[model samples]
Target: MARLRRFLDRIEPQFQKGGPYEKYFALYEMVDTFIYSPADVTRGSPHVRDAIDLKRVMSYVVVATFPVLLLMLWNTGFQANNAISQMGMTGLDGWRNWVMSTLGIAHDPNSVFANMFYGLLYFLPMYITTLVAGGIFEVIFAAVRNHEVNEGFLVSSMLYTLTLPPSTPLWMVALGIIFGVVLGKEVFGGTGKNFLNPALTGRAFLYFAYPAAMSGDAVWTAVDGYTGATPLALAASGGIDAVKEAGYSWSQTFLGVMPGSLGETSTLAILIGAAFLIYTRVANFRIILGVFLGMVATSLLFNLIGSDTNPMFSVPWYWHLTMGGLAFGMVFMATDPVSAAMTNKGRWIYGALIGFMAVMIRVVNPAFPEGIMLAILFGNIFAPLIDYFVVQANIKRRMKRS
Candidate 1:
């Protein structure tokens, strides 16, 4: 264990206490790096060793994801129950009745049970497959390079699954995981070296590879004929339709009654996760606040200007926070430290630009109603550039001061 501790100290920087914080506001940053420092895993040798390992890092991710996991269970059950009811497959007359009653299905008490069971049955296999496949690739590469298996997969696996609509095929899930693991992370030398979030990279691959299957339209409640519409998509299509005043309130959106990616529908749940992350100091709160404010500002600005007189343009800026995958992506994806801008100043730029892009894509692009996915990925691509300019500006300022 001592040896392992020393090893970790060599690689990870958190173990080395830089200095004392002068202000209380900086305490969060200090604690964030402090608790994790000893376990941060040193990169170099010639140090004390301990048992601290990557498994612990992975465990933290699993813990952070519990809120989303529980919510997925409930949401999936709700959608599937609704689907079964529409199919008339409510009771033991079940199979026979299912065959007989084609369209007018009644709600069955057992529907939720069956839906929950099937949802888990399907989702677990996909999860396991992704982990196994990605683990195999990661281990092989790690072995070849003579490095420990990076715990980065922990975040990537969960994030990849979360981004997927509940209705995604198991096979597609496997394929997407492979693509994300191999090409997204491995090809770029794994984890810290990757330019984009591997999970988002996999999601993007699946988006272009199979548009029909990954779309907001495809994210449904799963009742035989009960069609599911993403709130964002619906709002986009309704654009000032008389229904806007009568139905679809932003409150519902905030509460997550709307259809979307499985774990993304509940802003309340995501907020819980966010709070935990912030409290635990696993995430940088500054970036979170900056991105959120930026998103709200940009979205409101677009609403003021009115994008194309479409009914979607009428959606209040705050609605963007709850709609689609905005909440989930911002809280989780955009904050990844490695792919996000490194410097504090760069993070503000990185986050603000991401928020802006997300709103622009949602409002200006007719081809896609959901923009969080694209926007976050777009931000990942630009993170380095943002950092470059930040660093250059700092150098010039220092030179002037000198």
Candidate 2:
């Protein structure tokens, strides 16, 4: 450690202003600050600060996201193996399988290790693709704009990787992240100034642009020719019994034994991550509580309205939580500090509106099975407005009282 500090100190001057390496200082500083906190101090007055900086916040969120990431690795492999086994493939199938097959590892659906290994093969490539693409864009923007490369992309890239379908092609992965980082965040003046969650924004673009690849049961399961409707898709067609008929109990769904997005299938895993965030104060409980409250009230209202036509009308709040991307979005995406409402009152309202709209869209419209993506984006758009109203209301009441 002492040697590292001395080494950095020795060469650090080269990257300083007017030095030989000053042009690449942003890149050098990114690595240097990552290893140790910057020695630069407050240069002027009005320097309000908190113990938590952007890096700390990003690190906490990334830590909270790991449970889901671990589970996604297992689940992605499990789904692929299950589908392959159903089609009677005892051997490796994909490019990953073929590569690992040489190493004496067969694609055995029953083997936990095999499933996890296969899942890793899929997850690692996509993750690398996202990191590389996003990093390039981040560095380019930082260099041109003359700012330090923000660590926010670490969180964004990971979040984006987890949300994707396992069957997504490498090209699409690169393209989606390019769109996400540049348009979603950079266009609005980079990370802190962005109005949208960059990961979801990129995903939404892929979803609308490449509907064939993004939607339906074909993409959900990795093995070709294996068709399986997700729990939400089943409920939309024939209500809760259909989900049971498909052999998924609430317990299975909660524990993440369903086919869907890589990380979003497991409610329990998502909650575990959520608990970490809440405990660490990386996420706000008031917003989470409001989302659940809105989900409960809206689902109950739909139950009374009782659609004789749509089976989704009978889907309860509990089901809503475990099914689809609701749990994942509520925990990670909804709590994004930059896009979410800032004020206490606005947080509650913003969260509630997201929850309510998610359920409303899921039940009322069968076109979109999962509404969390759109709901959070919608909430992001309205968050500033919600905060403004809350702030204005407080100002008015205080002025009147005075």
Candidate 3:
């Protein structure tokens, strides 16, 4: 560690102002701070201090995502392996198959190692594409603007990758992330200045623009031609009965053994990540609680007004909690520090809005079955206003007291 620090100190001058590599200072600082805390620190009085910094906060979030990432790999592989076996295909036809064969790993859904490795083949490509494509833009913007590269994108890229279906094309992955970083965030002045979540922005773009690849049954399972409706989709079509008839139980979806996006399928895994984030204070509990309560309230209301025509109207609140991306979005997306409500009271309102909108969209809209992504994005748009009103209300109360 000492040797590395010394090495960095020695080379720091080369990347300083007026140096030959000055233009690349942002890249250098990114690597340096990523490995070690910044060398600069406040030395004056009246200073506020805390152990947690931006890099540490972002790092904790990445760590918290491990549970979801693990499930994403296992569930994705399990679904693909199960699909291939059901179809009785001899073998997959691509580099993935070649690698699996070379590694002597079988396409057995029951084999944990097989499932994990197979899923890794799919996840790695998408993740790499997101990181590289989004990273290039982050660097370009930082260099052009003469600012230090922020670590926010680390979380953004990971969340974006998790939001995607396993079979999403590499080209689309690159394009989505590029659009997200450029338009969703950079155009609004990047990171903290952006009102909308960059990840969801990119996802929404893909959802609307390239609907064929982003949604529908064929995209969930990694198999070439397999078509399996997500539990939410099944519920939307024929209600709980259709979901059960399709061999999807609430337990299966909750445990994340269903066909859906890589990370959104598993409520259990998302909860685990949520717990870690809450414990670390990386995520706000108020937002999570508000979202849960709002979802329950809305879902129960729908249940009371049961629609004979739409089965989704009958889905219980608990089921809604475990369905689609609700759990994932509630835990991670809605609690985004920059994009979520800043005031304590406003956080609840923002969260409730998301939860309410998510259920409303899922039940009322025939076009989109999963609604959390859109709901969070919608909440992001109104977060500032929610905070503003909260602040104004507090000011009025204080003024009245005075």
Candidate 4:
């Protein structure tokens, strides 16, 4: 602690006003404050006694995401290793397979160690690319605008990374984040000021800008030349039977052992994170409940109106909860405090709408199997209006009482 304090103290002065590094104060403060709480405390009007600050809030969300990130690591490795082993293709995977084979750990997706190892191999490079590219853009924006670097990027970058396919190219990761940070958030004045979740904005950009790279069966799995369709895709085409035929069960999907985005595969993993966030009151429980209720109700409605042509109609409510990005988006993306509805009543409406829309899109939109991203983005766009109506209702009630 003393060493850190001393180091901060020594470097802090250089970035102070009129100092040699004053122009780079934002950069210095970002790093220094991340390691140690800002010496500057709230000192103005409306100040209240609270130990928690923005850093703590951001850190809490980051910490909550850890379980998903860890699971994603194993899952990323598992998908790649499984593809290699299942296809009996050592050389087909090219050099990665040859190297793993040489190391005597080739093509063992079930091996926890091997999976995690492979997962790390894929995860770190993307994460680093995200941090470096995203961080560079962030720094440049902060420097140009002469504004303090928003600590929100710490959370946004990770959230965006978690939502990505493991096989996403490094350039796209950089491009998406840059688009998300700049146009999505910064143009609106950054951080708490933005209406959309910056991370999701970047992801949406990627999905639209590079549809071929972002979607399709070939992108989800890490192993080369192996295509695995997400359960949502299978359900869309042939319903539940197709999923069963694809050799995946509801249990495995619920457990998050299926192929999908890096951190979006496991309902269990996401729920674990959700429990932590909800327990800490970091996330709104109303939104979570609304989403769950909405999905269950909508999915059941679909089940009742079974389809002969589309088997997805036969998929049960439980399957809806487990498949695709439902749990992940409900737990993380939909609950993003900045973009979600603010009013208590609005939260229910916002969350429920996202849940309902997600299922509707997944079942109906054969071209886009995962609807969570779009649903949440749709909710973000209407959050203000939802809150406005709630506020109007409250005003009318107050007038009537008067």
* Highest TM-score scorer: 3
> What does candidate 2's lDDT look like per residue over 317-376, in tens digits?
899999999999999999988888988899899999999999989998889979989999
lDDT of 1 by residue, 220-244 (tens): 6544445667777777777534325
TM-scores for all candidates: the values are 0.80, 0.88, 0.89, 0.86
Task: Order the numbered candidates by TM-score, best leading.
Answer: 3, 2, 4, 1
Q: Mark the regions of model 3 whose C-alpha exceeds 4 Å error after superposition.
A: 1-52
Better of 1 and 4 by lDDT: 4
In angstroms, give how far residue 263 of model 3 lies from its true place.
0.7
Q: Order the numbered candidates by lDDT, best leading.
A: 3, 2, 4, 1
Candidate 3: RMSD to truth: 6.0
In model 1, the runs with Cα more than 4 Å from the true position are: 1-57, 90-118, 223-225, 240-247
Best by lDDT: 3
Candidate 2 vs candidate 4: the TM-score winner is 2
In angstroms, how far off is 366's CA in candidate 2? 0.9
Candidate with better TM-score, 1 vs 3? 3
Model 4, position 41, has a per-residue lDDT of: 39
Q: How far is candidate 2 from the true structure (C-alpha RMSD, Å)?
A: 5.6
Instruction: Write the number of the candidate with greater TM-score, choosing between 3 and 4.
Output: 3
Overall lDDT per candidate, in order of appearance: 0.71, 0.87, 0.90, 0.85
Clashing pairs in 4: 239-311, 239-312, 256-266
Q: After aligning candidate 3 to the native by TM-score, how far in Å is the CA of 367 from where it should be?
A: 0.8
Task: Give the TM-score (vs. native) of candidate 3.
Answer: 0.89
